[model samples]
Target: MTRKLLHTALVLSLFLPGCRLENLSADQLDLITNSVSSTFKAARPISDEEEYYVGRAVAAKILTSYRLVNNRKLTDYVNLVGQAVAIHSEKPFTFGGYHFAILDSGEINAFACPGGIIFITRGMLDAVSNEDELAAVLAHEVGHINHRDGIGAISQARWTEALTTIGSQAAKTYGSKDVAKLVGLFEGSIDDVFKTLVVNGYGRSQEHAADLASLNYLAATGYDPHALKTFLDRLVARSGGSQGGIMKTHPATRDRVDNVAANMPEQKSDAAHFSERSRRFASILGK
Candidate 1:
């Protein structure tokens, strides 16, 4: 699918709230019709390119609520660590490549957009003590992308209906009314993913699988797998009966801590590497 189609979907969802399609100029209608017609197809397994486009749309929806951090150095550092862990995952490359960004919110959360864009919140970064912990977090997010959890969050029924609508509408004339319907469907699919990410959260099994994946990636990349346990322990200790952000979105921290502890691999610590990475982490994001 084209970026133009993705952009048009986002623009229409955000700007056209209740406006009737008839109010638009002929040019605008043509743009909408053409964009929609170019994008969708009969429901099937989503392609990598389509996954990348969907991820971008979800990321755009997320940015509407949270501002991205503007610090280039910090952003670059995060990408460095993220890429380090991402390379070891099952699906190392995506159609759009991997990107990492920090969000300027103090919500203890991280979101993995469908393809490879990962957003770690300022609060989550603060919660991490060093590079290993940060790597642990990024690895966990990469696991979600590897597993296609974000794309899986979309409702199958809704997606099928959306594709069917496009297929049926494509045969005849693609009119403004058809465009509006498809746009609404597209917006609904986005909402399904958005709600799963921000509101309802992934299921326990998905979180468990991601945690296991994170441990594997961390060990493969030379970060202590137990770093994930340490981070989860901190979350458990600080939860204080609260339910918000990560605490709300992920499986219970206590359960995750136990799982990590149970499955943690045996690895020798490299003092020199740890010291160097810790120092670098502190340089960018103070202790």
Candidate 2:
């Protein structure tokens, strides 16, 4: 009996010795990967959670260096628009707070950051001719926030230094050097990556994703879907076909407009009415 028991124990021990425990379950890996992708987490392309965190940390620092336009009314008004559109976003506003700010910039631009921080340049606000136009711009930026564009950009880890270097000959793109460094975790290092993101601009695919998302949001909100196309048309015309720095990296505004027009849904439902406050937008910006 003792010999038989020893044999059984020995067999069990041998099998157990070869077995190894797994820290991440299949579900866990899928969750992390898909969730990050869905949110467009910036560190994703790097394929390291730590790298995403580090790059994002650098992104945060870069955001602070710019001069933000301070107006409680403007902030509140923009937030109202953001929240309304956000409720219908793919990811929704469950992750974190959605913030809106006005930057004292002359360029017609708006941007969304990871976790829902959004900014519209004073210049972009100046470009709006009506409530729908303004909503179109805000909705477009909100679309980026909702679809996680900023995070996605940070997640993609390709070295864009050559393009960035070419872009840095200008002054506006120069300030974003610190943000570009975070890409170094990939093939390069932080110093080089940060320089790249600021100068070269996000690739065409990202712009397409953002444009699609914006159209979806605009349709969802009952805003004229064509407003985005109109704005881009104006921008192209205004730029005299140059495509400028921002448009240069983004999908051709004309192409995107056509694409959006073709796919827009016919929705007659009221998009949660908003106080356009046209005069307020101009007055708050001191236009």
Candidate 3:
């Protein structure tokens, strides 16, 4: 476990500022010390902190392509709901934790960066019929984060090189020369995650995995897992002639719907609570 933790810290160290190393608790510091004796060639794991920095870079790259929505109330509502459901995920506490944002575009898409930063487009938000549906959408993205699918996009060579360099250094703090090498690796890492997640999209198996994770999170949080199927059904119908955003990035809706149906959890409906949740959602989005 110490080696695993140290490997994670080393992977995260690429973009981490030297000053932040001072903030590490005794345990994290000890892990770094122990890592000096270990060879990084065998193992490389992206730590929570490293994931946060990588996710931030990816988020910045995404912002260049899409404008962010400036509605404070709606953004707060999303963050609240996203955090509530994210708490039940396997890897819950990332470096800075999860943050939910909205894009101003009308594209039917959502993006989940390496760590926990998630962005949902306006059109996607508009498609959700209720709070449960919105939760389902967010849960899917959370699944991606839980599975570390974003980091999986990074090249094997990059991971090996970065981890080897950090492990050789013996501490999170690095010299200026080390920093230069890391900066190059950092740029490459960012490009890997951005191109794979935002451009090429995850593979079919990954999408299925995320969808399964979404169902589990939704079920664990008491949100109807069926809401995912319903939302995807609507999204497919609403996807007109142009296959942009999710239509372009995600797998076929019919396939996703079937998979979701096969793995959906059973829950007794509470009409009263459901109605109240729906009312709040409508009021918030002015639907």
Q: What TM-score, computed on C-alpha atoms, does each candidate reach?
A: 0.78, 0.61, 0.76
Regions of candidate 1 where Cα sits further than 4 Å from its true position: 1-42, 155-183
Where does the lowest 10-residue lDDT sum fall in candidate 1? Answer: 35-44
Error of 2 at 49 (Å): 11
Q: What is the C-alpha lDDT profile of model 1 across 109-217, one tens digit per residue?
A: 9999999999999998998999999999999989999999988877475666765665564334446777677667756777888888889899888988899999999
lDDT tens digits, residue span 146-260, model 2: 5545545543433344324323432321123323342233334443334433445555566666677777777776676666777777777777667554455343566666776
Tell me the number of clashing residue pairs for each predicted model. 0, 13, 0
Per-residue lDDT value at 3 in model 1: 65
Residue 60's lDDT in candidate 2: 62
Q: Which ten residues in a row have the lowest lDDT in candidate 3?
A: 34-43
Off by over 4 Å in 2: 1-59, 154-198, 243-245, 249-252, 268-287
Write down the worst ten-residue block by lDDT for model 2: 166-175
Against the true structure, candidate 3 reaches a TM-score of 0.76
Which portions of model 3 miss their true places by more than 4 Å? 1-43, 157-186, 240-242
